[model samples]
Target: MQITQLPSDQRPREKLLQQGPQALSDAELLAIFFRTGIAGMNAIELAETTLSTHQSLQQLFNASLGDFCQVKGLGEAKYVQLQAVLELSKRFLQESCQRNTVFNSPEHVRHYLSLELKSRQQEVFMVLFLDNQNRLIHQDILFYGTINSASVYPREVVKAVLRHNAAAVIFAHNHPSGVAEPSEADKIITRKLISALALIDVPVLDHLIVADVSVISFAERGLI
Candidate 1:
């Protein structure tokens, strides 16, 4: 049955207003975003079809423009809109992190970096500059290279912290091979960076190895 055929309270928009966005299922949430459907289908049906085709929402959002356009109600305009919304979510997370003074939540850090770097095809080294209170000051990608290799200069890392006037920092990099294990080079680089930064009294809070599904922390392993 069409969504209109359902009871007034059962409609997607009505349900959203009555409860909350969190109360809706994936299909219901997607239906709300779609707003309408093509001939012979309702928004709910289109959403269901889309979910079925993609299997995972991440895969769906990551789909290429040409690929995503093949969907029934999804077109160029909608694709661009989705991209903007996704970017908005990333910035929102970053803003939330910036508002906190003491950054002790490892999971939140992992999640934010996962969204930022986990899906990259090449390795990227990032630095999170923090103030004396450990609040986030800035996030910058300092280096990028092939999946297995990235050149990180301890002097450059030190220079960046000095440039930002940061008192502390968390180092992070993504493993394009999907392994979060810290290689021998990763461990060596971490120690060298620690020694170099210590000369100026800046602490290396953590070194996170971001993989496809997991984030490994050197601090958690007593390596920091």
Candidate 2:
């Protein structure tokens, strides 16, 4: 059945307007974004089919433009829209992180880091430069490639630290393999960063390892 033929209250857009965004299912929300559908399928049905193919919304959004365009009833225009929305959302999150202090705002830090690192196919090392009050100054991805003790150099990190003139920093990196457990190399590098940054009168507040399902915190584990 067509979405327009559905009961008014049951329609995705009407339901969203009557209640709230949180009240709707994933397919319903996606249907609202879709707005229209192919000849045989309604917007809701198309959304359902798309989600079923991707398995989850995260997997769907993380898909490359080419991969997503392969879906029925979608094209480059919608792909561009989706990517724009994603970039906007990330910027909003980054702004939110900047407004709050990381030490007292663990959730923001974790949430921001997850968005920044989780979808990456390769290992990336990033740093959140913080002001004296632990408020975020800026975030920089200093290294991207394979992650290891040798590859993540303290000298380059120290240079960035000096460049930002940050009073403190929270370190983070992603495990593309989806294991949040810190490796021996991870521990070794964290300790090296702690030692190197400490020499400049700056502290290493935490080292977070981002995996798909969870974020492992060295500070929470008593490693910091």
Best by lDDT: 2
Q: Estimate TM-scores for all models.
A: 0.90, 0.94
Candidate 2, clashing residue pairs? none
Which candidate leads in TM-score?
Answer: 2
Candidate lDDT (C-alpha), each: 0.88, 0.89
lDDT by residue for model 1 over 64-102, one digit each (tens)?
Answer: 898888887789987888889889878877887788763
Q: In model 1, where do residues sit more than 4 Å from their true spots?
A: 8-10
lDDT of 1: 0.88
- For 72-170, candidate 2 gives per-residue lDDT tens digits of 998888888888888888888889888877799898888888888889888999999999999999889998886432268999999998999899999
Poorest stretch of ten by lDDT in candidate 1: 99-108
In angstroms, give how far residue 29 of model 2 lies from its true place: 1.3
